[model samples]
Target: MNIKLWIDKGFEILLDYGPKLIMAFLIWVIGNFVIKLITKGLKSAMKKAKYDISLSKFLSDLLNWSLKILLIIVVLSTVGIETTSFAAILAAAGLAIGLALQGSLGNFAGGVLIMIFKPFKVDDLIEAQGELGIVKEISIFTTKLRGLSNKEIIIPNGSLSNGNIINYNTEGTRRVDLTFGVSYDSDIKETKSILMSVLINHPLVLNDPEPTVNVSELADSSVNFAVRPWCKADDYWTVYFDITENTKIALDKADIEIPYPHQVEIHKQN
Candidate 1:
């Protein structure tokens, strides 16, 4: 009699909740598939719109997570949970998490601002916070930099957006300023001419602006000539290094002495 009674009670319980269980399971399976399809369609649209890579990925992730969370709530409600109470609990949890992750939120906001304003773009040589490098990638939390030394540097977007960024690639052309010192005895006119010859012979130097060579300063031991040469931004370094070497060689062959600080010593006659 006891076994028959227990079996009857079990059957009654199954009859009461079996449909709800099946419904919840169906919702889970079908909701997940729909979410995948929606995310795929959104990605395809983003690609067609030519959205930036970072922004497109961020939005897609946000939508995916949001949909998944909603799907969970719907599945729970299908299983006979009170959805109003569940939603209240979710709101409270979201507030707590938001407060806890304030810094990350700030970084996220900064990333958004960076993407919208576009202060710097990929491959641009920028200097900020004493780090000089080319912009590699802009992520949701950080900006990547490929340092001139071939090292990778990661800077948080929060500070990067607020800080001063010196972009060297803004202009198509840049002027290379070089200071060369000659001994006071060296003829100023001849020295200037020698420098001009170096600039004129270099193919990278632009002729439109006309390179300026002038005596900028007179030190106690040397006369400093300011050599300003204009070149395309891309050829700046090549022209800089080449002109420096060629100037030295030309000055040496022309018998012009490049001046350096010298300490003169004499034996004191006591």
Candidate 2:
């Protein structure tokens, strides 16, 4: 009610809280600057270490967020705020969310592991979860794959890491497996010789293993020969197509009878 009383009250308030406010503001500013410096250092280190782009970005973001949250808590504590209550609430909320999103969090953790471990990379042909394709991108939750048929597949990171992952392109060489059938009466040695001629003439097929063309099995209808060849990974499909096309022609030229499924009829049945 009195101007004198109001002025005195204002002075008292400033004396009590001004120092605390200044200190809190200073702490926040210093904390934010420190956070920036640390994040920058992290980015530089990651870059120098030649980390993957997706992993580096995710780590940088994660570090910045963690620093910011820590800065907030430190600033609040400086201002004489009780941070324990907030911390308790945060812990409870985190626990509740973690419980609800257990699978998602597992995937996120799996993604981090995948990024760190470097099982497969973009453009690599990988087989996982019964799906075979070229990896397009690796994200925090899922990995994108471009199938051989050009279909896009999104697979969960958890499943990808937890299950078996076959990286076909990791190595430089691959084996081409082919099976050909011939009539039981056909000359086995001649059939093998013809197939071996086909393999030896193919430019893409490697000769280190000597190109196995041996009698594999004898089915009820036909005898099977296993034709195995080693070649460059990139030439696998090419060699496969060429061998399939050439084998048929070579066998036909050699007059090897490839029998079809047929049944004999008996007139005595009548």
Candidate 3:
């Protein structure tokens, strides 16, 4: 008689919960399919919008997990479990995590802004936050740069996005500003001519804009000529160094003196 009673109880429990269990299982499977479809559609949209690869992947993953969590809550409720409290707990936990990672969150938002706006991109030369470098990689929270000295520099995206950014490659060319000082007695016309020649002879210097040489300052000891040269962005440094070296050589060959301080001593006889 006890065995029969136990068997009846088992059947009663199964009858009570079987449909709910089956419904919850169906919901889970269908929710996952819908979530996948949503994620795939979002990825397609982001791709059409030309979003950064890293940003697209990150956002897709974020959406996937959030949807999975919501689906879990729905399945739990379908299985006769109260989920209002579960959602509330999740909200509270999310709030706590947000508070703890406030700075990181800001950086993540900044990175999203950067990827959307495209202020700079990988391999582009940029100056921001007093650091100049080629953009190496752009991540969700930080930007990596290959510094001029070949050092790797990592900058938090929050600060980088907020700060002033100077993108050198936008115009495809750069002006190299240089100043050369010659002795006060040097002929201004001759000095300008020599400087102009140095610019024209350099292979990297651009000629369309026409390089310029003008007297910028007349100091006590020397006359300063501002020499401006235009070159392809990638050739800026090469042109700058070459012009400087060539100017010195050309000036020396022409017998023009670069002034230097001289100390004269007079012997006193007692």
Candidate 4:
């Protein structure tokens, strides 16, 4: 008798919940498929809008998760769960999560600001947080950089957004400024002429604005000349290094002496 009673109760429960369970399953399947389509469309729209890759990815993920949550709520409600109770639980959980993830939230917000303002983009050489590098990628919370030494650097967007950023590639043309010192024995006019000739003859150097090589300072050991030459931003580094080394070689060929520090001691007779 007891076994029969248990069997009857089980059958009644299954009957009561069977349709609801099936409906919930259907909703889940259809909702998930719809979400996929929506996210795909969102990605396409973002691409058409020319949105930043990092920002677009973040937004898509956010939307997908949010929609899935809503779909789950609807499925639960269909299975006889109370919507009000579910909402209250969600509210409390969200509060707890927000408190626990303050820093991540701040970073996310900063990333949004960066995407909007666009201080730096991928491939731009920038200086921030006392580090200089080319931007490799910008992510939801972190930005990646390729350092001059080829090391990968990851920085939090929160700090990056708050700190000062020096974007070296914003201007199409960059001025390569170099300072070289010649020995005091060298004639200033001849040294200047040599420096100017080096700059003028360089094919990469822009001639429209002209290059300036002038005597900037008279130090104890040497006379310093400031060499300023303008070149396309993409050629700045190449020009910088080439001009510096070439100037030395040119000066050597011209017999101009580059100054270096030396110490002299006179032996006193006892």
Candidate 5:
């Protein structure tokens, strides 16, 4: 008699919950399929919009997880579970996490803006946040740069996006500003001619802009001539060092003296 009662009780419980369980299972499967289709469509849209690869992947993953969580809540509700409390719990947890990672979220938002607006790209020479370097990688939270000294620099995207960004590659050419001081007695015209010749003779210097040599200042000990040369962006440092050395040689060959301080000693004989 007890065995029969136990069997009846088992059947009664199954009858009460069997349809709900089946409905929940069906919802789970269908929801997953729809979520996948939605994610696939989103990816296709992003690709059409030419979104950055990292950003596309990150967004797709985020959407996928968020949808999955919603689907879980729906399935639980279908199984006769209270999902309002569950959703509230999720919302509270999300708020806490968001508060905890406020800075990171800011950086993530900045990175998204960067990827969308594209102020700079990988391999471009940029100066931002008091650092100058070639953009190495652009991630979701930070930007990596290969510094001029070959050091790897990581900067938070939040600050980088907010700060001023100078992209040197945009113009394809850069002006090399230099100053050469000559003896006070040196003829200004002669000094300017010599400096212009040095700039014109250099192979790397651009000729269209026409290098400039001007008397910038007359100091107590010497006269300063500003020498500005234009060159390809990549050849900046090379042209700078070459022009400096070549100017010294050319001035020395021309008998133009660069002034130096001299100290005369007075000897007393007892």
Candidate 6:
């Protein structure tokens, strides 16, 4: 008799809880399907609108996960679980998390600023945070760069955004400023003529700036002339290197010697 009574009590418990369990499960299932559909639809729309792939994917995933969490909370509440205390605890936990990740949050904000303002893009050579490199990637917390020597550098976005950035590729053309020094005795007019000839003949040099060749300074050892030439950004280094080497050759051919610092013999009162 006791066994039968226990069995009847168990059946009553199942009957009372079965409908609630089924309803909770249905809510979860339906909510999950709805979330997936909405997320996919939004992603498709954004893609069709030519949105950034990374941003679209991130937004879609965040929305889906958030909706899933809300659905789970609703399901739990339907099963008679106390949600007010749970929500309070979650709020406190979120606050603590935010405080702990203050720097990361700043980086994230800086990253947003970078994306919006777009000071530089991938493969752009830039100087930021006392480092110079080509930008490799821009993430939520940091920007990655690969140096000319193949070294990898990671800079926090906050520092990068706050500090000055020199973007070498911002303009289509760049000026290559070179200073060449010659002996004090060398004819300045002849040297200037030779430099002008080389610059004018070079195909890469732009004509608008007119290839400035002027006496920049008189040093202790020699007289220096500034050679400023404008060329396309991609060809700046190549043109600079060629012009420097060729200028020396041309000066040598013209018998203009480059000065070397040395001590003069003032020996002998003895």
Q: Top TM-score: which candidate number? A: 3
TM-score: which is higher, 1 or 6? 6
TM-score of each: 0.78, 0.91, 0.92, 0.81, 0.88, 0.81
Candidate 3 contains a number of clashing pairs equal to: 0
Q: Which 10 successive residues of model 1 have the least lDDT summed?
A: 46-55
Q: Which stretches of candidate 6 lie over 4 Å from their true place?
A: 1-26, 41-60, 208-210
TM-score of 4: 0.81
lDDT of 1 by residue, 77-191 (tens): 8888889987898899999999999988888888878877878888888899789998999988889999978899998888888899998888878899999999988998999
Candidate 3's C-alpha runs over 4 A off are 48-50, 264-270
The digit string of per-residue lDDT tens for model 4 on 11-65 reads 9989999999999999999999999999999999989976678789889999999
What are the Cα lDDT values of the candidates?
Answer: 0.90, 0.90, 0.94, 0.92, 0.94, 0.87
Q: List pairs with backbone clashes in candidate 4.
A: none
Ten contiguous residues minimizing lDDT sum, candidate 3: 201-210
* Tens-digit lDDT track of model 5 for 185-249: 78888888989999999999999798999999988889998899999999999999999999999
Alpha-carbon deviation at 12 in model 6, angstroms: 7.6
Off by over 4 Å in 2: 48-52
Instruction: Give lDDT tens digits, candidate 6, residues 161-260.
Output: 8899999999878899999999999999999999988888889999986788999999988999999989987788789999998998899999999887
What's the alpha carbon RMSD for model 2? 2.1
* Residue pairs with clashing backbones, model 6: none
How many steric clashes does model 1 contain? 0
- Per-residue lDDT, model 3, residue 230, is 96
Candidate 2 lDDT for residue 121: 85
